[model samples]
Target: MGFLQRLGSAFSAIIAFLVGVITLVSLLLGGNPGLFGDLPQAADLAALLALPAAVLLRLVALVIALGVLIGIANLLLTHAQRLMRGRALSAALLGSFALTLFWYVARAGDTSLLEAVQLPIESSLAALLCLTLVGGAARVIAKRADIWSLLFVLSLLIVLLASLPWAELEPLRAWRDWLLRVPVSAGTRALLLGIALATVVAGVRIALGQDRAYRG
Candidate 1:
């Protein structure tokens, strides 16, 4: 056999062995043993080891959580660096001022000052993001001219119609409700079911030594 094939078989075997060991350990530690309950006094052994096991597990979990948070912060910093570019000092100063304002508003409970300072800033940022998204979507639609682009246009129309005076546009409101309750609801359910089935398949493959995703 080729080296790669031999290596894969060896890896699969090792994974299978680990799966078997984990299954055995889980069964021992009060998992549904059912009719095989009389096999061993393993639960007592698990109870004896539980204190140290819990401490070790908590430490590992804490480290993993901290690592994830640090990774996310690093990613945000990278994006902020790209956005700020040559205005890093100005951006930092502005961010600090905004944070200070937020803290002062929180502690002072003064709505007027916050309303004067925050509303325009928030509105401008929201408008910028919305315009950026719309521009990107428009570009994609212009290039593709597909059914998705048509649907996007239709959705925007529906949103515009829905936002009109509700008393005068009652029919449009009903149309919006029907669109949300029927197609959107069905699509959401289908997506959820697909996710659940995929999760089950992945778990089964991992348990049966057919998946090597964790090896990465």
Candidate 2:
């Protein structure tokens, strides 16, 4: 049994490696004939290379849709069980879900209900988030009292004040714009690059059969 399992794992790893490589190459070199130089039928070769990635992407989208449906069904089932146990929160959740679903179907895809209900909820959450950030910054400054902490608090204060409509905040608004345009943009890009690198590393591990989840 152990030997059979090892063999199955090896087969799966080989298949995964080949598929990953094909998809990566197709996506990288598929659309640009210039990458292939002046070779004969370069465009045709590029098209052929692109086909596999396109088909695989469509399959991935279909799988994602199916997964979403499965998730919704599971949520409903779990919440329904809780509702049977007299959980008011679960009952509210299920009620809201049913109402939203019914509204969507009944209105022939009208989303006015969502705009009226969801938008205010989202705005309120955003306001709460701003307050949470301010509170956290204060706590950090109180506990640490370091240069970085002070800078963080000052930056937060400036940004918050800049958001006000008062004429006294006009100068701070320029500073806020510069902070957002330069440092914030750079930090955001750095985070995105890091995430991309991490994703690539994970993909490489999976492709190389080093990921433990694929051992089965």
Candidate 3:
């Protein structure tokens, strides 16, 4: 676990450094493209900056996808430890089939294969999630029957109302939009600002030689 933590921290630092360098270069190019005659035009500089940005974004996405897959595999292995051999095999086969179906749909791109599998997979997942949520709500209501359960029911009702036909649910739609655009947006901005501030603080500490965890 310590090794994994160190590895994750190192990987995060590398990603941060790359992003910082790319952002600095993009700013320099955008601000003064003539400095690099190879990309003198605004469009050329933009394109040059965009290429690395896109590549970095894709790299991050690939890393996240791989991490999720690894986590799921680990979870399955852990659960398989206690299951009967036949049940374990069935679980593994079902998991692999679902993952393969998702992968194929993702890459199918305008093919009939996507059309054939996408809807069923989506519907099944949605149904499963709904059932899980309903069961959880029932348990919570039975166990506590308090404000939290009331809040959950209210939130679910709001979501259902928001999903109705726009003409019939204009008020609920407006309320949802307001909730998202105002409170949610404000909270998101605050969280991002906090992250930026923390990053700056960490950078300052490292540069001042105050952070020694990275040394050993």
Candidate 4:
């Protein structure tokens, strides 16, 4: 760590430690003393966690929800195009399929009533950037009998089908629950453990001014 960086980090650590101690003390003393007062109850709160949208507001609500989908496609297409330029067709196709699939899973988090949406003006523009790339990649990989991407895309298609309107995807929904309850549940616990360990290490390193990330 550089001298100035160490100095700044030390200052931040001292301030943060003091603030945290003060917060705990305030809570124990039976009074809210922070800048913010009471937090909203979970039952009273809107379904949006990642969205700052107030569902009571008609237009703002629509914009924030739709904006999540639009922003995801825009960010993903940029990287997919770069992969396409490198003629990494497998990577490109897999990237597109994965990006769409993950975003679908996340945005659909607990909302079961609505069909997944794709805006023509936005989706067409986004798909145009990568679908052709995926096609070209598909052809090239076919010659080598490479079916990794082909398989992934097909699996993603099945997942999409499971989410579609006409499909009695109740079975898929059950499978989704199982996926979370079985592997995903365990994996998340493991990931949290990993994150906790990393946090402790990072905290120690920062306190000792050995973290390069904090130096900046």
Candidate 5:
């Protein structure tokens, strides 16, 4: 946790430094887009500066890199608090962290993680299927009527149906896609509004120091 916190802070610093440099260059050369600076007329200024369109694309990459750095900061804050509170490590948390970190290191045509680790798309689906089977079987063997196990069984049923190449599921898949494309898009568009409302309520509650998710 200490290592992760430091790593996150260091990454944030690097991103900030790069952003500052690019912004300075963009303002200075006013067009070259040096390293990560965005200079639209860079080509027009190419003869004056002698660069290419490919160099301009670095600005977009820098923007994306900054976003990733911020995401790591968020994760560091969340996990550091969890660690300080002595929270037990859960399978979901560990698995998600591992997968995210692995994928982050496996991008840009570097599929080494996919080849050497469990980051492949096919592997993920297979793992999900195995988990569903194991969960259902364990519940049945234990003679327990767990809601979680039941939900897994129900989802597996749907997956099994979907996995089959049947005409019935064709329309179902189309409808599912449409549902996600419509309501999901609307929800995403309005997500900040919902977050603002929730933040206000939570802020009032925490004004009295009633929130302890970050408390050590």
Candidate 6:
């Protein structure tokens, strides 16, 4: 049994690696007949190469849709059981979900219900978040009276003040725009690049059968 398991794992890893390589190549090189220069069958070759990637993408989308449906069914089932056990919160959640779903279907997919409820809740959460940030900045300055903390608080205040719709705060708005356009943009790009690199590394590890999860 142990030997068979290892063999199966090896087989699975090989298949995964092959599929990953094929998909990557198809996505990168497919549907670009110009890349082949003046080859006689360039268009035909490109189309052939693109076919696998197209099919794979559709399969992925279908799987995601199915997964979402399964998740919703599981959520309802769990909440229904909880409701039966007199869990008020679960009952309320189930009732709300049912009402929202029915409302959506009855209105032929009109999103007025969502706009009425979700928009207000999101706005309230954003207000709370701003308050929380201000409080956290104050605590940080109190705990550590350093230059970095002062700069952080100053930037936070400037941003908050700039958000107000007053003509007098034009200078702060200019500063905010510069901060967002320069430092914030650079930092965001750096973070995204780092994430992309990490993802690539992890993907390579998996494709090479070096990932522990795939070893099982």
Best by TM-score: 2
164-212: candidate 3 lDDT, tens digit per residue: 8879788898887877788668988999999999998886555344564
Stretches of candidate 1 off by over 4 Å are: 1-60, 69-127
Clashes by residue pair, model 2:
none
The CA lDDT of each predicted structure is 0.71, 0.88, 0.71, 0.59, 0.62, 0.88
List the pairs of residues colliding in candidate 3: none
Candidate 6, 21-79: lDDT as tens digits:
78878888899999899999999999999988999889989999999999999999999
Query: Per-residue lDDT tens digits of candidate 2, residues 147-206?
Result: 988888887888889999999889999999999999989989999999999999998777
Residue 114's lDDT within candidate 1 is 54
- Residue pairs that clash (backbone atoms under 3 angstroms), model 4: none
Q: State the TM-score for model 2.
A: 0.84
Rank order (by lDDT, best first): 2, 6, 1, 3, 5, 4
Error in Å for residue 214 of model 2? 5.2
Q: How accurate is candidate 2 locally (lDDT)?
A: 0.88
lDDT of 4 by residue, 132-167 (tens): 866876775576555766755554455556676665
Which residue pairs show backbone clashes in model 5? 46-50
What is the C-alpha lDDT profile of model 1 across 1-216, one tens digit per residue? 899988987877796757544554444453333434675965565554344445545786999999998986776677577656875655664575567669777878656755776788898899899889878878877898989888977876786789788698888888888888998789889999999999878776776667756563
Residue 41 displacement in candidate 5 (angstroms): 15
Q: What's model 4's TM-score? A: 0.31
Candidate number that wins on TM-score, 3 or 5: 3
Segments of candidate 2 deviating more than 4 angstroms: 163-189, 212-216
lDDT of 3: 0.71
